[model samples]
Target chain A: MGFLEALNYPIYVAIFICVYSFLAIGLNVQWGYAGLFNAGVAGFFAVGAYTSAILTSPDVPGRLGGFGLPFIAGVAGAMLLSALVALPIGKICLRFRGDYLAIVTIGVAEAIRIFARSEEWITGSSRGIQNLPRPFGDLPYVYSQLAYLALVAAILLVVYLLVERQSASPWGRMMRAIRDNEVAAMAMGKDVPFRRLQAFVFGAALMGLGGALYAHLGRSITPEAIDPMIASFLIWIMVILGGSGNNRGVLAGVTIVWIIWTASEFVTDQLPMEYALQAKYGRIFLIGLMLQLVLRFRPNGIFPEFRPTQKDSRKPDKSDKA
Target chain B: MLDFINFYVVPGIVTGSIYAFAAIGITLVFSIMRHAHLAHGDMATMGAYIALAASTMLGLPVYFALLLAIPLTAALAVGTDKLFYEHLRKKPKILTTMSTLGTALMLRSIVQVVWGVGTTSYAKGITRPNDWFGLKIKTNELITLLALAVVVLGLAAFLNRTRWGKAMRAMSDNRDLALLCGIDNARVITLTWLIVGGLCAISGFFLGINTEIKSMMGWNIILPAFAGAILGGIGRIEGALVGGLMIGLVEELSVLFIPTEYKAVSAFAILLLVLLVRPRGLFNGKII
Candidate 1:
């Protein structure tokens, strides 16, 4: 494979990095900025993916379909719907701290996956809805995937800038205040739980946006794409490995990890193991190893987020010592 | 009609006992460690698999296999703690929780890679179902009930009697206070994992024997197992024992009204509703 052939895979990986980076940022918002240990990111991601697919796909008749809504509308729809679902989940989970919240969110995401698997009418169950219309589906030699990649990148860039701006805003500062010292924040007359809820909802909406972008890029919608493990574990690793509180750190983390993931997947055949088994697990092992190493050495992640001189790190205050 | 009650309800109790057995390990570790061992189900599976590898494969007797698996799983739990979870200490609870998430994924992959990602059954095939006092129950199911009763009783005695068990209780009550009281908190924590590992193995054996054995078998039941743990009051062993039984009975008896597939959701439904309505859990935990 020459440059062009090799380039396609990496280019595709770039797109994945772009999408997952936003997903990580979304998680970084919920977890890093707010003390919400949301393990159900995959649920919001699926919500975004399914919403986009359902609205754009030609298959379903009765519900929201056949409009061929513009990509922007579909993306916005996913964001709105995700925020809607997040409102209650955020409120509910905001009350619990640490392990209790983790268990609940993981269960919630799994339940969502189960619901997705069972609800055939809306999501088409296991068969999945494919050939979801792209904005320029019929244009010849369009490098359609490349175009989708550009579109996703643009959305991600906007989200990144917006999150950066908001993280510096009064509300964002209040979010960090609650995360750092809830008692003090409450003493300062900040509605601590309410602030956390806002962060949760905002973070979840970002996840929804990433999910919608990913679904369109993949050119198909399937329940399997949104495994809770994939949504939660990978996003957690990204935020942790990339400086969780740092926006730039998050970008570096997402890019580096996704590149390794996609690249390892490509090169697994050369690995010295049972070809059949190793190929399947190659991706998981790589990510798992990196997660362990990062947690061990740089629990704060690779690039420590630049703490604004006035603000403290919004990361979870030291809790349990291993 | 009377026969149906004996067959279903009685059998339901037996099945519930097994779930309760499994839930005990999860609850113990969850309460103590403050983060769940996502691989609790897999620990059970690993125990069952260890029993198979040691006893049946090596030509050891059934009891001998279990004897080996008990200690081995206990050791494995310690190793897992040191290797994976140890790195996550003092990090945010959420971050440590994610580490367990990573650990679960890693352990699952290791199980799949080692065992070929397929279901493996016990070599000693279960022989027969029996009619005891007009109630039809499989021998394995009977064993499940007996094991649950014995384990629960044994755990109660251990917690109430032994110095180490009491130390564990102290730690569970409050880690900082436990340390302040001159309790070797680390040693107590390790012992807790050991006991949990052994008991969890038995639960694993029963689970695989009752159904098909697969690597994902434990992972699949994780949600329900968590359900049992939470329902029982997160840290209380007695609570876990009761909660597991309740979840299991609800799941089994629920099949009559629901499609069997939906039976799995019963525990989660209980989990969600419980968390929503009663966050402190059925036992009231620290509050009461």
Candidate 2:
């Protein structure tokens, strides 16, 4: 490929990285801070994608759509729909151990997938919904992509600031406390399950936003557009490898993992015809191996969550000293 | 009623036997090792594929190939435990569960790569069902039911009557106490994997015998098998057997109400219902 063509590939990947960063950040809130396990990240994502598609896509003859809402309205609808789905599941599963949540989430995701494939009126069956309007779609290809990238980055910045601020606030501290020791938190009269449910819903909403961004970029939505297991697994690896509790680390992790993931896809596509299929599987095997290595060698991840020093917290405030 | 008995109930029982067989293994592993073996279904898939290889390449009869696959799959299961899970035993059991999800993907991918993605069957010609006084049944179905009975009885016998089985039971009941009493935790774990692996092979083999062997078969079974385990009670072998059969029956009978394509949803629905109503399961399984 020529330099400009190669540049095009990286720009596309960069857009995905931004999209996945939103997912990883969402997962960080759930798994990292609240110690909730959501194995169905793709479910919330699909909900967001389809919700936006239904809300914003122009009128179709047979299927549900043609709301013709603006892009921002679609994004809001995506987040709301995702959180709505998360609400009941989080309320029920958060009462038990995280493992229950994991299983339920997996089930929920699978159900979403089956529904997407079967509900023709919703997802348009196999053909999928198309002609999703992009922000700068009328511009030349390269400029449109760059514009999308800028738009994604702007959204990511706002999400990052909000999440960081939340994690620093009393709410984050309460979540961490609940996760670290639920019994102790309960003893202190904290509503453990409710707090956990909040984190779970909020995180799922962020994942929905990521999905909306993805749908707008691709200009379409399909049941098979994303491999549920692989997408969910990749997000898990990003959160775990990036330092679950750190947003910066999550963003970094998403960039690194997405690059490696897409780079491997490029390499696998280059193989001879017969071996190419096997190469796809070989890549999955390597990703699994990567998880093992990370868990064993560096369970804490690259940038472990920065637990504020005990001594610093103990110091009296300047106003109190005065 | 007779038609229902012949068509749905018998098939459900056969299918349930497989699920129960797999769930027994899952329950055992959950009780002892303390995590859902998400790869259990995949391991069963591996077993089925190995049998296919043995039959296709070695020119063995399908039954003989299944017999051959049993030991091979068991050994592989043990090896997986040693290679992947042995180290993570110290960490939270939940982390081990996560690794198994990855392992499940890797195992399924390996199967797809080695066998290719297309569906395949062991023997080309279809076998007619043998009518036994009006209840039509296939020989393989009969064999599956028999094997499930034998395996469950043997496991119960082993746990109650044998030394090592007692050690395993002790470990499951109370690991620290078992250790304090001088039980070999490592040995029990290895033995646990052996039985679990062997059972996984049987379930997978039976599933393949009844259905076509496809790369995605294992993934499809994971939810139902887990549902069976949890429904029967996570740590109760007999409970899992019952639960597995219930799920199998519900799945088959569900077609009467819903579209066939949504069959897989039955298992998840059963699982969610059980989790909601009686998380400890019918037999009062360990709550962990």
Candidate 3:
């Protein structure tokens, strides 16, 4: 393969890494910053992908949309619709403990998958939405790929900066406080449930945005693309492995995991046809085993949450003497 | 009326019995471990497949295959606890819950790799329902109900009559108090997993017998089973049974009013309604 040929694969992989970064960062906001377990990452992703596809694609006679709106509108609409969907779910499940939230989210994701599969008018009933516009469609294949990669990376950068800033602010501290000790936070007059809902909805919006990016890149939105194994659990492993609270750590995690996942597929394809299919499952088993190893050895992740020492108001500071 | 009973109600009861088996195991894990065992469904799937192997490979009868599956599945459950969940016992319960999700994925992938993902069943030919006066009931359906009854009664007797069972209950009620009372928490946990695992195997085995066993079958039923567990009041075994039956019936009956594809929605709807209206569940089980 020529230099450009090799570059094409890297660009493609990099674009996916950028998209997955959004999911990991979104999950980090929920699970890392706020200690909310939102397991339905795929659900939000599907909503976003479908919304964008419906908005941007040319009019289809039988289906719901084909409004032919601009790409920006579709992306924004994706975020809005995803947040709207998360609102009630977070409101209901957030009142309970994290485990309840996790189960509810899983169900919600499955329900969304069913809807995407069966609701022919809305989601095209497994055929999915095709002929969606790509931003640099007129460009050569390699250039378009590069452009998309740059675009997603830029968006990821912006999201990372904003999230980092938020995590550093007092609101972030309050969220951490609520997460670490709900009763204590409540005692200190933090609106625990409402704050949780805020984090959950916010994180869901990012996931939706990620989905929109993915849909537009692929120039189609399909139910299969939103499988829990890839869209949800993969993001989860990324977040948990990267160090949930650290934005940079999660990005690093995204890069590491996506490489392993994609690289393994290539390696498995080299195997005999019969064994290849089994190798695919073996890869998944490896991912699952990786999570167990991470949980057992480095529960806090690669870069643990940065904890600034709090000065006690009741006593004189000892740091000055040191 | 007979058609309704045969088509919806009878099938509902059979499936409900299956759900009850899974839900009971979930409730046991939830109450005893203070975390959702997210792998519970996949564990059931594993059990069902094991029974299939026993019957197909070992040439055992289906019931005898189930008997073999029960102890093996119980051991698998306890083994997972020892290998994956033991150290996390002192950590946050949510960590263990997250780990179980990974375990779920692992278990499902194992099933897919071993069984090759295509659907399979114990027996090849379909058994026609036996006519009883006006009512039609399959022999397997009858067997399912009988099995459910036996399991429930046996579990009730064990929980009420045995010291170890009482210790398990005490731990569920209050871990610190149970510990202070010199109850061996480890033994109680192991005993709980043994019961839960056996229940999982039975549920999976029956679900496969009634329907077909696919890799995704247990994952699909997991939502309804959870709905049943939550509706019945999380920690109550009887609540799980009732909830499971209700969910199964409602799901079956929903096909009459909505597209058959949307039957799963009934469980999701019920789960939301229960969570909104009765977070403590119908039997006043612990929310924690």
Winner by lDDT: 3
The superposed Cα distance between candidate 1 and the true structure at residue B141, in angstroms, equals 0.6
TM for chain B in all models? 0.92, 0.97, 0.99
- Model 1, A146-176: lDDT tens digits are 6667777887888889989988898778888
lDDT of each: 0.77, 0.88, 0.92
TM-score of each: 0.92, 0.95, 0.97
Task: Using DockQ as the measure, name the better of candidate 1 and candidate 3.
Answer: 3
> Which residue pairs in model 3 clash with each other?
none
Q: Is the docking of candidate 3 incorrect, acceptable, medium or high quality?
A: medium
Q: Write down the TM-score for model 2.
A: 0.95
lDDT of 2 at A202: 98
Ranking by lDDT: 3, 2, 1
Candidate 3 global CA lDDT score = 0.92
lDDT of 1 at B258: 80
- Candidate 2 local Cα displacement, residue B133, angstroms: 2.5
lDDT of 2 by residue, B62-146 (tens): 9899889988888988898888888999877888888888788788889988998898888788999899888989998999988
lDDT of 3 by residue, B262-284 (tens): 99988999999999999878889
Top of the candidates by TM-score: 3
Please report how far candidate 3 places residue A37 from its true position, in Å.
1.2
